[model samples]
Target chain A: MHLLEIQNLTKIYEGKKVLDDIDLHLKKGTTLGLIGPTGCGKTTLLRIIDLLDLPSSGKIFFDGIDITASNVKDMDIRRRIGMVFQKPIVFKGTVYDNIRYGLKVRGKNEDSYETEIFKLLDSLGLAGYEERDASTLSGGETQRIALARVLITEPDLLLLDEPTANLDPLSTEKIEKLIAELSKKKHTTIIMATHNLIQGQKLSDQIAILNKKIFQMGTPEEVFLKPAHKFVAEFVGVRNVKKGTATQLEPDLTLIKLRKINIYSISHLEGLVYASIRPEDITLSKMKVISSALNEFKGNVKGIVDNGGLIEIEVDVGEDFTVHMTRKSFLDMELTVGSEVWLQFKASAVNVFECEC
Target chain B: MSEIINAFFQAINLIVSLDPEVIEITLRTMFISLSSTFFAALIAIPLASLIHFNKFRGKRSVMNVIQTLYSLPTVLVGLLVFLLISKSGPLGNLSLLFTPGGMILGQTILVIPTVIGFSIIGLRGVKEEIKELALSLGASNLQTVTTIMGEAKYALLGAIILGFGRAISEVGVALMIGGNIRGYTRVITTTMSLETQKGNVELSIALGIILLSIALIVNLILNQVQER
Candidate 1:
């Protein structure tokens, strides 16, 4: 069953539309990753879902009940949802008092909850720091405390907005692991906004790429393998793309034409097209080699960019094309700034998209 | 030179001896000033918070009125309160003309605007992101306000101290409204004025020393509290 649903959500500020006709749905116990560029309404969407901002016009249903226009008194819906902001805000008090703020506001002062609070703190690596001043904590420590503060409430849905944007790599890894473990243990539904695509792929069960609109939404594997729009394909780091008109020849084979170049694809697409190939799918050879691959282009290495473990080699095959290969391959081929090479890839590796021109 | 030395030694002797009349006047001064400052803070802090946090029509006009009131002369406030409490005035039936309550009323009117103006400046200086974070945590409007107050507690305390210091040292309002009645409303400043007019340097110097000591103690306590 759908746990939350938003329909036709629109928000306008100062005669400009910030959010335009956004629709989304979430299922129970699933993590949804919201991926977008900066200023792409991701945080605004989270704010609307948390009921911090009223939509210009929309219907929001949580637990099969419409909660639009509800006031703070009618906040049973809010009780079931908790949000962690991008920057951790620790009140001016001891860490224990900061965590106890929400509970105290709700008129709960039982000492029995302290045990659970301690356990949560321990799990988030904040043990023995309850009585410490909140202002003395580091950025990562504060983020953990913020998460621990919300998780102790045991809300059914947890919303985190860029929770690890400011953390070091080790802290980021720890937080990602803690999130995964919490989901498995409590069946908690999580909605997180992230600019890190690799982290999104590792942590989220479902991914939604939001541009000016909902560019695509599906399971991480489904969205990564079959992006419905060119924006989503590029956002997920699928780099080698050629804009063309696509004709479906069969269930597996298609034809794409760009200017004077006609390319055949074993993937089917119809109408105006974007033929995308993951950079890793193409192989670079220093010399001509025989291969069963149907598409092989002789090109010159226009540029080589070293990005951590992989080398991104831009090949000019009578047209601009990008090919990503391992650092080992570049070193073995002795590829340099002006190296000549043959780029080979199977037709089946091309992802075809049919959308408006 | 001998008379000046006599006055100074006798002033110290009066304080050490805790002379009844001098003690009574000093105690009355402390009571009136502290009570008025406390009452002003109680009314001003929440009013300032409201004005700082919410948007409303006529807000600029309201702020302008507050800013104008903030610099209102102590003598002017004394005259205004004096008219209201005088026998032929609007509140004549209450008979508060020469009482400590009348002095307190005048001082409260004088100090309230100072407290409110500084409190508004303090609360307004807190970052907007902190408020948004509290709101996103599903805190109600009251909770948000409380959080902001907690965050700005140091600034608010400083404002209260400033108002208290101003109220305690203000002699114009206290002298005008209380009328310096002996054993009833004769406070430190009024007594000092009367003693000096009669050329009695010992009692006048004693009262002056008490007032300066009280002001110094208040300032020291404020500094210590702020340091913490």
Candidate 2:
């Protein structure tokens, strides 16, 4: 059975629907990365699942028990689930007291958890800092302390709402590594809402794209490689989107017409259509390659951008198309502005969707 | 100016000499004000916490009413308490009129609104994030209240001190309710009024000095608490 299931959850705030019919399920010991733009109801979803607020409709089940029921003791459910808010909230006391507050309130003997608490502190690079004042700590230190406070309780399910949103790079790395280790070693279920797409892709075992609703839900590969919606395509950084008209070329083949160009894709989408392809899929070559790939166009390398480990080359066949490749590939091809190149990708690489507007 | 200086000197001499009447009045004043402040705090802290943390219909209007009552005239409060404890009044059986108890009661009523008003502001001053953080950590409603109260400790203390300051310095309630009975119900404010009326400016100036000193101390502490 799924450890957590949100069935048709809807949340309306002040007569405005912030979350509309969001349905999701997560197995035990897995991290579900919730990625969305701001005001997309990521925090609201987490708040409802954490039992901080009641849903307008639908039910949330935890371990097959309906936790959203009015009769369920919320304290019992809340004790088993921990949440880290976006802003770090350290109680008014020493770091030691802040970290121990959760365990203390849950009726755990503080003395017995001394070693465990210290171990958590050390793991988070907070050793020897227990006696320091929590309020006096820096932002990164405060967030680390907040996480330690929640983690010490050993909650069954941990909910993080952009836990590392405002941390320094070192702190972000530390928190990400800590989360990874915790999930792997302790098998703690985690649901993290984050705007950092790269961090979401890196940390989450399963990804759910929430934008007033569940736009997409799948593995990182599936969501990034084959987005089912235009919002997901744009959010996932697939930038080569073009509006075109698709017609049946033959059995199991669809042809889309663009201004001054025609591209073949494998889709049943007809009439007005929108097609997107990831920048990485298109290969840029200095010479024409003889291949069975049906979508090949000769264009100039209009712009060459050095993006750290990789290079983004904008090739303009009829319209500007971005192609990503390693810096080594760019150097090997001797690519520069106005350099003639052939952009090639298989027909299956184009993801066509029915245009809604 | 000379007369005023002479009165100031005479007042200081009276205080320095530890006159039994002045000592009794000062102590009684402290007792009455402190008791009123204590009772006010006992009622105000929890009431303000409720208003601060919970949302209910008419909450804003209730808060506005409390705020308006902060400026309630002490004479009006004194009249209200006097009528309640008068011989033909509802609480007449208590026989608290013209005594220290009556003064304390009137002072308590006089300070309660300010106490509650300032306390609500102080408690509300606690960051919303702090309260939410505590609740999200699985804390019970009571535990969260404790945490919030703990966070607003300084401001709440300031509120108490402010109420005590207001109670100790005001004369209308104590005059009307305590009747300023010498050696029994007399306090700093009432004593100052009586001495000044009797043309004894020296004693009046001495009591004024003491009252001003108390106000100064309260304000200093208030500034320090707020700054903290």
Candidate 3:
């Protein structure tokens, strides 16, 4: 069942449309990842969901109840939907009091949640720091406590906005693990906004790529493998694409022409199109003698950028193209800038999208 | 020159010896100032919090009026309270003129605006993120206000100290409204005025010393609280 649904959500700030007709639905006990660039209204959407900001024109239903209407009380809805902000805000009190603040406000101050609170702290790796002053905790520790504080209220849905954006890599990993563990054990529905694509892919069951609008939404693998829009493809880091036309066709292959180069299409797509290939899909060779590959291009290396384990080589084969190869393969080819080499990728690995005919 | 030195040494001796007359005036001053500051805080802190948290029409005008009141002279407040409590006045039936209650009323009017001004400044200084966090956590409006006040407790304390400092050191209201009646409405400032006019430098200097010491203690306490 859908636990939360937002329809036609719109917010205008001082004549500018910050959020424009956004619609989203979340199933119970599932995590939805919202990935977008800065100022793309990710935070604004989350704030609207939490009822921190009223939408200009929209309807929101939580468990089939309309929450956007003026008659509905915010306190009742907020008790069941918890939100964690990007920056951890611990009040001027002890850690325990900060966590207990929500419970106390709800009239459950002495309801014997000590065990559960401690369990949450332990899971977030914050045990034994309960009595410490909240102001003195480190950034990561404060974030963990903030999360624990919200979770102790046992809200059915959790809205997190860039929860790990300010943390170190080690802290990021810990927070990621904690989020996963909470969702698994408690079956809590979670909606999170983050800029880290890899982390979003790892944690989300469904990914929503939001630009100025809902560019695409689907399972992460589906969206990454076959983005529905140009923006999504570019956002997801599918870099090597060239504008070309379908020049030849067959049951298994289709040929396309770049400036003076002929390239084979991997998919059975026709007409004027943009053909894209993941950099990692292409292999580099010193000479033009490939075995079972359907397409090969002899080109001069334009540039080489070493990125730790993998080196990305930009080659100018009549039209520009990029190929991804490991440091081992690059060393074996002895490739350098201006080196002439053959780039090889099977036709089955290329993705093609139609441009205007 | 001789008068100043004699008054200074005699004032010190009175303070060190804890003279009964000096102690009586000091205690009266403390009581009046503390009561006035307490009353002002009770009225101003919540007013400031309301202005800080809620948006209303005419809020700017209301704030402007408060700021104007903040600078209203103590003598004007004294005159206003004196007229209200004097015989043949609106509150003449209460017969509160020439009493400590009259002095307290005048000082309260004098200090209330200071409390409001400082409280507004303190609560406004609280970060916006803190308010957002509280609101997001489902805190009611009252809870949010209390949380803001708690976060800005030091600044609010400074406001209270400022009010107390102003009320205790003010002479016009205490002398005009309380009438500086000996063993009755005689506070430090009013008694200092009366003793200086009577050429009793020792008592005037004693009262001055007491006032200075109280101001020093209040300021020191405010500094310590802010440091923490």
Q: Tell how far residue A217 is off in model 1, in angstroms.
A: 1.2
| Candidate 3 lDDT over residue span B1-228, tens digit each | 987887789878988999998888888888988898888889888878878778999988988988898778888888899889899889988888999888888898899888988888988888998887887787876787888899999999998998999999998999899888989999998887778889998888877777788889999998997786
Between candidates 2 and 3, name the one with more favorable lDDT: 2
Q: Which candidate is the best by lDDT?
A: 2
Q: Give model 2's docking category.
A: medium
Q: Rank the candidates by DockQ, best first.
A: 3, 2, 1
State how far residue A121 of model 2 sits from its true place (Å): 2.5
Q: What's the TM for model 3?
A: 0.92
Best by DockQ: 3
Best by TM-score: 1
Q: Write the per-residue lDDT of candidate 1 for residues A86-176, one digit (tens) a residue.
A: 8887888888887876676566764778998888788877889999999899999899888887886777889989989979987787789
**Model 3 chain B poorest ten-residue lDDT run:** B135-144
TM per candidate comes to 0.92, 0.89, 0.92
Q: Give the TM-score of candidate 2.
A: 0.89
Query: Tens digits of per-residue lDDT for model 3 on A1-357?
Result: 799998988899889998888888889998989999998899999898888898999899999989998899888888898899988889988999899888877778545999988888888888898899999999988888889889888889999999898898877888899889778988889998998899889999899998756778889998898776667788999887777887557786889876688788756777787788888888778887837887788889999998897888899888777888888878888988999988888887777777744
Instruction: Flag regions of model 2 displaced more than 4 Å.
Output: A242-277, A290-295, A299-303, A306-309, A316-320, A325-340, A347-357, B1-3, B54-57
Candidate 3: the clashing residue pairs are: A266-A347
